[model samples]
Target: MEYNPQSKQEPLDTESEDRFASEQPSEFQQPYQYQEMKQDFKHSGPGIASFVISMVTVLGYVIAFVVVGAMATSVFDQSGNLLASASEVIITIGISVLILSALNVIGVVVGIVGLALRNRRKVFGIIGTIINGVIVLLFMMLISTVFVNAGGL
Candidate 1:
């Protein structure tokens, strides 16, 4: 009953210690649960790679269009005569398109693999796959139009 400021406090009772221990779960007791949580929180590298490739492909396409448009605009003369032949420009554009198409194919494949893994970053994979698919479809349509115009349809 005496108020002694310097006195050591009594140790916790056995019942109180047991209750406190029971309230907080030990990390080692449920390591498997934590392992699953860690796996769930892991970042998906393939998904991010696919998204970056898709974005780069889109940017390449835009640059190609700009370059080709500039060439087409400048290659013609004031009287619509050929200031410079367009065959070389056309060939260069064709080669660039082929390279971009190959990149889009790779992006789509990587995106599919990422989606199959079912990671938290699957959205990036899904978007990349969609963009690649659209580009492929557009390329196919362009090829079909060329065939039709050439009387090979």
Candidate 2:
């Protein structure tokens, strides 16, 4: 093309192409679209459901511990065979389940805390997620043990 500076239109050459691609707006040209997303109880982040669920898990563990503690105290009352009696077995199983349940509750609490502090620190979020996973595993293990003890094995 011939030189046409006065034409008031620039040529679409390589330079213009590069400049166009490289150009960026000082701020976003379009505002960020704010959309409310539908969330499920399982998928919700550190929201009400998480808090409620964590508390529920903790409550469940506490209940189990209380029951086990009472049962353990009762076990010693029954005399005779000190090794393997129904009461002793019950106490042992109960204690084990209670411990696992407590750990699971702790994991849920950590996960909830992580979700709460996700905005402040990503590490907290990750830790919370890990804890939550651990809790789930613990719960699963607890269930499996119960089943095995119940003769489901």
lDDT of 1 by residue, 1-153 (tens): 243343366766799679768866698675334335434655467777788988999999999989998889877878987665878778879999999999988988988887787536577778888998789789889999998899954
Model 2: how far residue 107 lies from native, Å: 11
Task: Tell me, by TM-score, which candidate is best.
Answer: 1
Candidate 1 residue-wise lDDT at 143: 90
Q: Pick the lDDT winner.
A: 1
Task: Please estimate how well model 1 matches the true structure, expressed as its whole-model Cα lDDT.
Answer: 0.81
Local distance difference test, each candidate:
0.81, 0.57
Tens-place lDDT per residue, model 2, 1-153, is 344354548557898658655664446575466765433113335443344444566566667667767766545534644443456657666676666566556656656665665324344345445545666787788788978899955
Error (Å) of candidate 1 at residue 39 is: 10
Model 2 scores a C-alpha lDDT of 0.57
